[model samples]
Target: MPSTSDQTLENQNDEELNSLHGKIKALRSVTIDILDDSNRQNDQLDRTGNTFTQFTNSLFSTSRHHSRSMAASSTVRQYRTIAYIVGAVVLLWLVLKLWSFGGTRSVPPDGVNGEYRI
Candidate 1:
């Protein structure tokens, strides 16, 4: 039979081993969780990168289209500018004509026959 002290020592060793095992299991669970979180973050980053790329491509295409349209319509743009200037001139002329037509009238003096009233 084992001595009483030896039994006590064995029990203590068993308890310590169980505690160490529990700690190891906890560490393994935490490591797995970390790996899962990292994978999710990587997937999200990839999706974001792809979305940004698509948006950039769309923006570039729109800018190119706008540039082409502007280049092609330069004559139209010039005509529009001239029309704006002519419209402004016509509006100014109309305003001046109306103002002159509505000129102020001279009022007669306040008198009975030819002598002014006191």
Candidate 2:
């Protein structure tokens, strides 16, 4: 049988120990929650990284496609311009040839009296 004061002191010590244990359990629970949150964040980061990579690849692919098309369009425009210039030059040359061929001829100094010449 202990004295009343000793029993009171023992009860106080038990209460303090129980409180410490409860706090420890709560702290451990919080730690586990933090770890779970970090893991979830890590998973989200991985997904975001993959998405960014895919987006970058898609942009590059689109850029390449656009660049190729633009290059082809530029080439086509150049060819069309050259064709137009060549066509115009050919048309001018043909006109000049026809003009020279159709020029007036001078009369012959001696005229023939044969039927074909007349």
Candidate 3:
């Protein structure tokens, strides 16, 4: 019952609708892929957070253990600390003396004999 012109218009509209349907399907597929990727990233982040938490707990435990051990007899005694300080001072003085000696070129005075310079 439709005229030729109406039939042509109806066919064009049907073709446009099919094209739009195809585009919607593509968009849905892309959205689903994005959702899957987001979920994967979230899971990875959660695992990393758990790993960090475990590491923090381990660090705290080690720190507490170290403090406890240091409180026991492993700490440096007073005489040992004093000896160490004295040894360090002597080492520093020796190093400075050596440095000063290295910087000076030993030359005999104009009239002084080389044998007398030692």
Residue 38 of model 1: what lDDT?
A: 100
Summed backbone clashes in each candidate are 0, 0, 0
Q: Assess every candidate by TM-score.
A: 0.63, 0.58, 0.63
Q: Model 2 reaches what TM-score against the true structure?
A: 0.58
Model 3 lDDT per residue over 1-118, tens place? 9999999999999999999999999999999999999999999999999999999999999989867765674446645766888999999999999999998767665565545354
Report the Cα lDDT for residue 19, model 3: 100
The order of the candidates by lDDT, greatest first, is 1, 2, 3
Ten contiguous residues with the weakest lDDT in model 2 = 109-118
Per lDDT, the best of the predicted structures is 1
Q: Residues 15-71, candidate 2: write the lDDT tens digits.
A: 999999999999999999999999999999999999999999999999898678767
lDDT of each: 0.90, 0.88, 0.88
Error of 3 at 52 (Å): 0.3
Candidate 1 ranges beyond 4 A from true positions: 75-118
- For model 1, the run of ten residues with the poorest summed lDDT: 109-118
Candidate 2: which pairs clash?
A: none
By TM-score, how accurate is candidate 3? 0.63
